[model samples]
Target: MKKILVVFLVIFAGAVQAQEVLQAGFKLLENGQFAEGAAFFKHYLTTQDATNKTALLCYGRGTGLSGNVTEAKEVFGKLLQRYPGDFEISLNAAEALMWCKEYAEAKRYYEKLLTEKPNDFAANLGYANALASLFEYEKALVFTEKALQIQPSNDNAKLSRKYARLGLADYFVKNQDYHRAAPLLESILSENATDKEALFAKAQLYIQLERYNEAEKIYQQLLQLTHGQTEVYLNLSYLSFLQANKPLAFEYANKAVESTATQPQKYLTARLGRITALGWNGKFKQAFAELDSLDSVFPNNNDLLIKRAGLSIWNKEFAHSVSLFKKSLRNVPSSFDGNLGVADALFAQELDDESKKYVLKTLEYYPNQKDAKDFLAKLALRHAPALTTHNFISSDKGGNASKNYQANVAFDVATALRFNVGYRRREVSNSLENNSANVQTMTAGLRWRVKPFWLITGAINVTKLEKDGAVAPFKTFDIASEFRLNKFQTLELRHNSDVQSFTAGLVGNQLSFKNYIATYNLSTPFKVGVYSQYYYTKNSDGNTRNLLFASLYYDLKATPVVKFGINYQRMTFEKRMSRVYFSPFLFRSYEVFGVSENLNVPKQKFLYQVSVAGGMQRIEDEAYQATYRASLTLGYKPSANIELTAYSLYSNSATSSVVGYSYSETGIKAKWILLKKQQY
Candidate 1:
């Protein structure tokens, strides 16, 4: 019985081998004669057991190649289950599954082979392709890179990488990230300059960005490289139509249809371009004829339908445009262009509700549509009244004199100019001083946004002062430019030279001081900065003194809203009159530190910032002062045009005692933002 069993087993093995040869031949036949070969392979699979792995693989391939997807999937699955560890069989099964469009199963098998041997180039490439087909581009890129690394010379892997890159570019483009897509497309073109697809993508991007010159260059390059390919010709013709070059546009349109490319869509594009150019060039009848020809060729094409609707709308044929829009919507019910065209036609026909319905529908389909957004904004603004508000206050006080206040209403005429006129009052409290004054001042200024980093300002202040003894009148002219280096740095240069004559208690004292200072400052939290100023001052004694000053500061933010800063300053005078004093009249050194917290309020307003500062100053060894100062400022915004500010400053100095003089004053102030503008 053992001998008989051995002979039977050998006979079965021979039969299996013979069947495998027959199956391989059948697969070859399927490659050459698909119909008859598929019949033979199917008949053999039914009659003979396909336990032979190679035979089963051959049967799977034959069925897959012959378009018998369901049968091919079944056979591949059986082969995988029976020969789980066979890499060749698994790869073939995966390929068969891919042909069947069973991507998930194909990916599973490919991943299995890859897991066993990651450097399996064929498995890696196949897996990546499967992932790309499923639109999993980012994951596909990883495997595609692996495949290229394993076999750098593989053209298939290189092409797969190109597709992956193009996929990523398209993804970014769909998300409106044009900046990201631009570099990827450029890299692809660098690798293959004549890549017509990448060139076309670049042209489309340029068109969307309104970069007509760049778009024209790319379209011309594509036309030359592709030898007047129909798509390229159509692109060029459309661009010419946009530029109103009728003759050139019609020539390119003719060339597009004359090309050997067989795509019907290319012919339709050519027809549309030619018709649009003819209509724009005043050959209306000819343009209509071209549309009729397109209708004859593709009666159901929705794009052509929409194009006809647009032409009707442009020609003021409201009824015709409406009919075309409705017909197009039968095929594409949610078409963005069709809905927008219907809305426009209804609006032109005075169908308000219908127009709004279609417009809202268009926006529902394409929420980011620019035309729809603009239309909605304009409609909203039509029913709302624009509001304007303005308020301002100004106050000043001099030592040993009465206080003055000015109230004004400001109006903004333009970004660069503002007009303000208000009432002013001045009074003294003590009867012995017997002082009263009143004057009205009109102030105006011009503020220009010279650039994103600079502002130019010029203002004039005319004032009238009255005292018990005499009357004093003065005018001041100031011009300044503020420079912004970055978020945290600023420099201001100003020229201010004014003359003022004072009266006694009622008229104030005759004291005059004139100076022009140019200052440079740099400010940043956690950064070291420097400030310098040079000024020339003339006192009532007719002595002119030149002052040079420099300060170094560093700021630290201990919390989000609290900032602390320390500064050191050195000042020098240029000349001294006393022969006993050979050195400069003023030599001062100072060091100070302070902390401030910023308060933010709603409606475009802010509040200050109470801070305490302490420092020391020395003047040429003649007098030294240790100082302590505290300040409180309140900022109020009555309107967008005005800010009212009031602050109190208190300081105690040791030098005041040594010099037989002490100075302390508190003041309130308000400023109006006459003009505010920004430029880039």
Candidate 2:
């Protein structure tokens, strides 16, 4: 019995010694001393052939830490194969694959581990990291939440959750989903209030939503917390610049430069911020000097090259801007910013084809770029007019032969407001009579954005008509508000009113009308809307009209721009008309098709749209009429501040037998865009 007891003790002591060696090896591997740890683990495994799960896991970890990723992966795989239900082996394999950057494979292993141990903190955290690496941020947040739930006190797990949340927030911000990102950033700041990164993100979100006061508050808080950290000061400076607070912007920008640590990134950001502030404050010379200084500091920085290009564009140095943009593209061959900058410079130089090439190149890399899309749309409108021509052939009563000539010009304007103005003019002649009727009008408005969810707008219309010894003038004033109900739904309220007096040929009419309308619009790739309107008239009688309208607009997004929009309106008269009236009086119905494109010019850009619309309206059986109206417009911008527009209108009513008259007009206009109290 004594001899058997001694043998048993010797065997047990040897096994314990092997286990201690394996633990020590794993500890070294964990601390990143991989080669020596791997050697120790190999020796221990050789002496003890039937090593337990812990020793096998340690061996795999050591192999991975020593840069033998293949061997580590195979070791973990064998362990998993032998102990199929072991979460530890599964987690080890997942972590090794993560270090190797095999994010998809790591995610598979982590998910399998979680299936076995639902609350396993390591597995959940590993899964989050894997998903994050793959840019599956929404899914990553789920795993991060599980990890937090399992180990609430684990700092690593908490930090991982925070990062995942931040990733989600950034995704929203990039997609222009400010309303969604704002709350997420707010939650992050509420939890870790001193997190400078989160605070900066929150401030940017506020700025995008146009909550300038809130953004300023958060920026000030960040500056206080960071004691004028370079990033905080730079952001504050940008905010000040946007709000037109030049002195404060300059002060903060200088502070940003002074506070930057001796790091390339810090110095670059500070210098760029100061330069931008100077440019926005109208100190172009100082801004250019700062750009030159930046060039001296970081001669090879592609980011600085891009910034200089942007400054050149702002200063109207188109040739220099193009050169800098092209140079930056050499350093960063796939840079979307560089491509876009080059495109803008080319556009400014009126090299439409060359500019379009760069714009398309940018779209190839960044398909969802809104600025690129808008620029392309504008370009399409610019070149459309020169490609098409029209002629008017007509003969009237009194044995008179009538002929007319018309021309159009189109263009675009850029500011906080983006506008497309078009104009067309006509000249009429006859053997018995000759008169030039000029019809001039303009349609200019912007999608006024106060926030992601709220918008307010004001637009105006002026019309002048010339004919036989009579002048007809019409003007409209409009105010509207739109609210986004969700990603796909919006509600709008609009008030549009027009006052006009007409005297031409035997028709002399004066009318004043006001329309109050509300619309519920839902949009996807296709747009659908239902609207109701109450119109008050102060012309022939003090009457009111209640109208219900529905419209569907579809876009094929194809070349040649195939768009189909149809609207149906039903009118109910509150007071009967003196003239015969038709029931369910179809207020407006039309189908339009056209091709449009933009043309780049030396001083400005042009937008040309040509469409043919035909429809019919009914008042009664005898009063019914078939209507065909051809409208053409040309808008020209010789410079940012100068615009010339011409417009023409020709219509004929079969029932009225009054071959609808043709009128055209042209006007030269100038704008002071940045003037104080100009109400652009």
Candidate 3:
């Protein structure tokens, strides 16, 4: 066979070239000129015996150096078959594969070579890198450790060990095992302060732990070292947002959004941070628009949907908020934000029965959540929470004789109802002697949620008045219907047969009036609110009056401490609206203009408010007096859910009387709210 003979001749020629290379002792290839070395080895292979071990070894090394690892492996395999146990040739083959970054193939040869030269430093280090590349850090560390023990002061061994630790740390981090990953990352940074990998890991670790100040410090260092880190910018922006620095948060978020990183997750984080900054700045419309855009980019992301739900809740769109929360729960059923948002939105909508279910669900996942606990407590009292009221009024005209005092307490009579009982004593007297009548009254009241959206309430009072040994007995009725449109909106219509009996400070020898009042309130947290009332009264002395009142408050989002508001009132008389025969009092017509200020100083558990009003009082048919009134309210919250408040009002003149006089009234309100634990 001619082909067999040609192979024999090639083998013979390779052996001759090997003899020549031995005489030359690799003069051309030994100088580290890899191109020339490859050419010289190829020239030797052209006519030499392919089975020549020396020439074959040189050829594999040359081909591997020339970046043809597969060909190099083939050349080495030929010689390895003939001399499979030769150290020099086998190591060359493994090293060639490693050079080409074929780590898995190189690991195989290294395994075989280790049996021959078990203590070889190069083999151990190479094997460690191979295992690390395969993400087998646990196994890789074993090899790295052995390499270090064999060569204690070797830089290559130390580098391999460090790499193994970094690889293992990355592994732990991916598994969310930050506690195990932290020490390894710190060890790397301790040796090299500028280790970017370790620094980034450490910074993220701090972020997860909520050690934000420390994270900020490391991120600053990272910025100086690496200018193109999108996540760092986004994280810093989030930190700014948490600190309530809206402008700074927006600035950093813009930087992250402008980054050129190709990672979609990086862009997602940046955009999320930007959205948060927008929300913090009170840019709800803009934030919602941007959220719509984010929805297109991340259609199924639970975090974005939860964020949208939170914004909806802030906007007082409870129905929409619940919808978004439900969608988010569809994807991540146990998400803390999603579940809690559902509970809160339901509570806001006055759907406490449904809210209770979700609140318990939230507590199942997050047992120590304050919001859930607080909501549970409120849910327990939703149908009929307890209520208490106390009133003490003493006139400046006389002293304790012209005084009225009342106290009442109410609690749940049933799931959908409540009941209250109280008694009031009124003494009318002048500056000298007991010259006026005294009246005593006992009152009872009840409220019932007759339907999902309807509430009915009624009150009854029995009164007995004595003047000059003559006694008059009378009974009064008060009833109302309430419409609970949503958590933020309500409407009520009430009618009272004796308005003076219900008015805390009015202790006069005057005819009583039957009053009808319609009140509307739309209020929510961290928002502007409006309250309006239309009141009509008809007195026993054939007098009728009508009053329209409007009050509004705009609470600033950025500074929740301050609220700006105003109140406007107009009163119109149709007849002799007041009939205090013995006193110089007659209600004709009046109007009021008032400004209100509410303040809760930053970083304090105290709240305060002041309101001042000026009005024109029509005391006589053609006479009027300038009436001034002011009020102060102070509140101190000593602990969670407990509050103490004091309120005082001063009037420059009594606007409803023919005689102008000033009076002061003060009251205190204390509340102890307790959040209860609920079972899932």
Q: Write the per-residue lDDT of candidate 2 for residues 192-285, one digit (tens) a residue.
A: 8888878888888888776889999988898789877888888888888667577799899889989876444588788888888877665778
TM-score: the better of candidates 1 and 3? 3
Model 2 lDDT at residue 629: 52
TM-scores, in order shown?
0.47, 0.51, 0.60
Q: Name model 2 segments beyond 4 Å from true.
A: 1-86, 115-119, 261-265, 282-297, 370-680
The best candidate by lDDT is 3
Lowest summed lDDT across 10 adjacent residues in model 2 is found at 1-10
TM-score between candidate 1 and the true structure: 0.47
| Cand. 2 Cα-lDDT | 0.63
**Which scores higher on TM-score, 1 or 2?**
2
TM-score of 2: 0.51
Residue-wise lDDT of candidate 3 within 107-145, one digit each (tens)? 898898788778977677677777777777789879888
Comparing 2 and 3 on TM-score, the stronger one: 3
